[model samples]
Target: MEYYISNFSNVKKEEVKIKGSKGSFIQWLVTKDHGAHYAVRRFTLEPNGVIAPHVHKYQETVIILKGSTKVCVGREVKELHENDFIFIDSGVEHAFYNGMDPLEFICIIDYVDDMSIHPVDRSCI
Candidate 1:
């Protein structure tokens, strides 16, 4: 078996460019190229940042690492703080918003053939 080690400091943070997204950054910790069946990503949102409502084919689990965020999943909205986590089922619409403090979290998802994300209207959330 192969082993991989990474340092968050060495990972490059890329700006999130999805339509309607603002002040969000993403860092890929593990990817398919790394021989990982699942991809692990770290996301950081600047204060008041927002990730627009969207749904994807792959499900994901999000673990809050720092600060706080308001998450809208399906028809439910909840505030999450550090150490809080949530699971989002496949095809479920979800959105994230940072509060006054910057929000940071880790997301784990399986690498799937269809990973395309479809945007959902804000009114749907």
Candidate 2:
């Protein structure tokens, strides 16, 4: 299979903007164009940064690489720390938020087209 390798530091970081949120997120990614059905990216949330509850047409997962975060699924909220992993089923409403310190994690999701992936926001909290 055709392939490529990249270090997170070698990738570009992007900002995350939830429709009605005050804080934002940033990411470093390894996309599917290199030959994979899914795309993975690292997300870093500034204090109070929130990823409004959103649904994925496809399943999604994230691993806490550093720092900690607060994740919400349905009505339950969970705290995640380094080495923790969170899995979200397709169509499930989920989101991430940071506490006092910045939080960071790596997210994995099905890859469709770069422009077609819009995580639909839903009722969170």
Candidate No. with top lDDT: 1
| Runs with alpha carbons beyond 4 Å of true place in candidate 2 | 112-124
What are the C-alpha RMSDs, in order, of all predicted structures?
A: 1.4, 2.7
Estimate, for each residue in 1-125, the C-alpha lDDT of model 2 and write its tens digit: 47677787777776676565446665546565667778787887788888877665777789998788888876789999999998887766777878888777888887543333345546555
Number of the top candidate by TM-score? 1
Residue pairs with backbone overlap in model 2: none
Judge candidate 1 against the unseen true structure and give its global Cα lDDT, from 0 to 1.
0.90
RMSD value for candidate 1: 1.4
Residue 4, candidate 2: C-alpha displacement in angstroms = 1.6
What TM-score does candidate 2 get on C-alpha atoms?
0.81
Could you tell me every candidate's TM-score relative to the true structure? 0.94, 0.81
> What range of 10 consecutive residues in model 1 has the weakest lDDT sum?
116-125
Worst 10 residues of 2 by lDDT: 112-121
